[model samples]
Target: MLTKRIIPCLDIKDGRVVKGVKFLGLKDAGDPVEVARVYDKEEADELVFLDITASFENRKTLVELVEKIAKNIFMPFTVGGGVGDIGDIRNILNAGAEKVSVNTQAVKLPQLISEASKRFGSQCIVVAIDAKLVTSHQSPVTSNGQGTDKWEVYINGGRTPTGLDAVEWARKAAKLGAGEILLTSMDYDGTKDGFDIGLTKAITEAVGIPVIASGGAGKPEHFFDVFSKTSADAGLAASIFHYQEYSVRQVKECLREKGIPVRL
Candidate 1:
């Protein structure tokens, strides 16, 4: 079996690492470079840097900051947020990111996914999907307790719904040559209760490419749960690692003890 990956995410806003619940009420986590260095030392399989507000603000990713973080980390780095065109993707990759993740722009101009993947091998392209449950009830749907629940694609930092079904979009992105999918459950984001297993399972089953499960990871066991229950190739969390609730090393150890293959 391939070793599972443990990734720590850095959600950047105004050049500072931030974390929030359900993509609302953001809080400062720390300096990007410093946080990247720490995750590097902790042996995170990969690092994802997302400029959380870039798309909404209509600005490009902070290349200078990406360069700074890239220099401090030894692991594979993926950068996303406000990536508009091929030039932006080229600039981000040139800044030392191993891959560039496109979400909002890719939804609006799906050709971007095909074009970027062709120009810079599929391995260098990651298609991010921010999805939330489309429940009939009025209250928020944090966890996909029901396997039948449907998900809709949201863009612009989870601010706009594209009316796209999450699973269908993943399939389309994969067909378009996207090498991987970074699927985030906006409903469970920052809840720290656990991952949206239903959502993860849906996307993973829909696409052959690797899927990184994001949102709702509260503790080490949450990582093990997501890995064991779903076909997720990687488990990503921000608040837990950012707030020092648990180290990447600890999470890996937990996985190993649970018989989950990981690069310790």
Candidate 2:
């Protein structure tokens, strides 16, 4: 197995890091650059810096903020939120983000995925999907009618539903040349119980590229469960790390001791 990554997410709002429950009731955490520096010192595999309100606010990502945090951190930096076009992608990358994650825009204009992947290379494009569970009773008609659970894609920071199936969307994104999928479970976000293993497994199985399992990570064992139960290439959490419930180093040590391959 490849070394599993333990990623610490910094969800930024109004130029400050924030955390919330199920994408609501957001509370401040700290400055983005300072929080990023702490994650880098903790040896996090990558840093996901998201301007969570960017899309809803209809503005471009904070390029100056990205540059500030990017300059402070040594690990791979991914910036997302309000990334709508090729120029937005370029600006983020040029601002020092190694990867630009597109969510609302990707669903609205999938051609942008192809265009960006071709222009910047697939590795530079990370598609972020915010998913929430839709049960059989809610939808009631799967293609197979197996009463299987479904996850629908949401954008604009989980306020808008696009009626796209999460698994199918992942497959499409991969085909469109997305290098990776950052899958977040809206149902599980900030709950800190654990990752939605079923959701992670479904998307990972459907896509060929790496999938990062996100949301609801509470403890080191939560990371272990996601890695052991699914083919997720990485596990990302915000509140756990932001609140000091666990550190990236502690999570990696737990994963390694549990016989999962992880960088120390």
Candidate 3:
């Protein structure tokens, strides 16, 4: 039995953590370093830090913030945003990331995955995808969850929709040697409703690697529904954990109470 994981995500923009609805109306949460320290104390199973605007700004993830957050936390941490080549990967690792997450760059140049996997073990190469629903594109690349005819890939914090089928891209990333997939559902992002279970199930089933489900997670029970009802290996959330709506220990306890196997 796979022990389900509870992860807290820090969406960083301009070095500050922010939370918003469907990736809009961003509100300041706190310093990434401060929030990370709290999650570490709460015994979060894993931590994910995303420089939400790094790609948008067309630059590398803020190493200073990454260093600050990394030094404060002791658990496994994945840092992403605007990571392009081996040098960027090396710099992030040197700064303290346990894993380097690539999104826009990987999608643009698939070879980056193979190269990174070869340099750092596949386990350390996490491919993060930002996807949204579309309606007109037989395969419309979606940037955000505003609306659409097809599911598309968006880069730079859901600002540009890459006309590509998210499902197909998941498979391709895995084939290119991605070890884990961190998928965020733009449609469900910041909803506090629940995960897009259908999307979670799709990527988890399509890819052989472990899939980290992000975007929508409201209550502790929602976490249970995600792990048991879908193929996701881990449940990732931001506002819920960031605002202290629930603690990692509390979530794990709830999962145990619900008869879902967890590390506790």
- Local distance difference test, per candidate? 0.85, 0.83, 0.80
lDDT by residue (69-158, candidate 2, tens digit) is: 777777798989888789888988998899999999999999999999999999999999999888656532222223267899998889
Steric clashes per prediction: 0, 0, 9
lDDT: which is higher, 1 or 3? 1
lDDT (10s digit) by residue, model 1, range 1-264: 689999988888877777632222223236777677777877899999888767534343378777777777777989888889998899889888999999988999999999999999999999999998887763345445455667899998888998999989999999999999999999889788889888998888889999999999999999999999899999998888776778889999999999999998
What CA RMSD would you report for each candidate? 4.2, 4.6, 5.4
Candidate 1 lDDT (Cα, whole model)?
Answer: 0.85
List the candidate 3 regions with Cα displacement exceeding 4 Å. Answer: 19-29, 55-61, 136-150
What does the lDDT come to for candidate 3?
0.80
Over 63-160, each residue of candidate 3 has an lDDT whose tens digit, in order, gives 77768777777788998877878888888888888888999899889999999898888888999999876655433222332323346789877888
Per-residue error for 238 in candidate 2, Å, reads 0.5
Query: For residue 183, what is the lDDT in candidate 1?
Result: 93
Q: For residue 223, what is the lDDT in candidate 3? A: 89
Pairs in steric clash, model 2: none
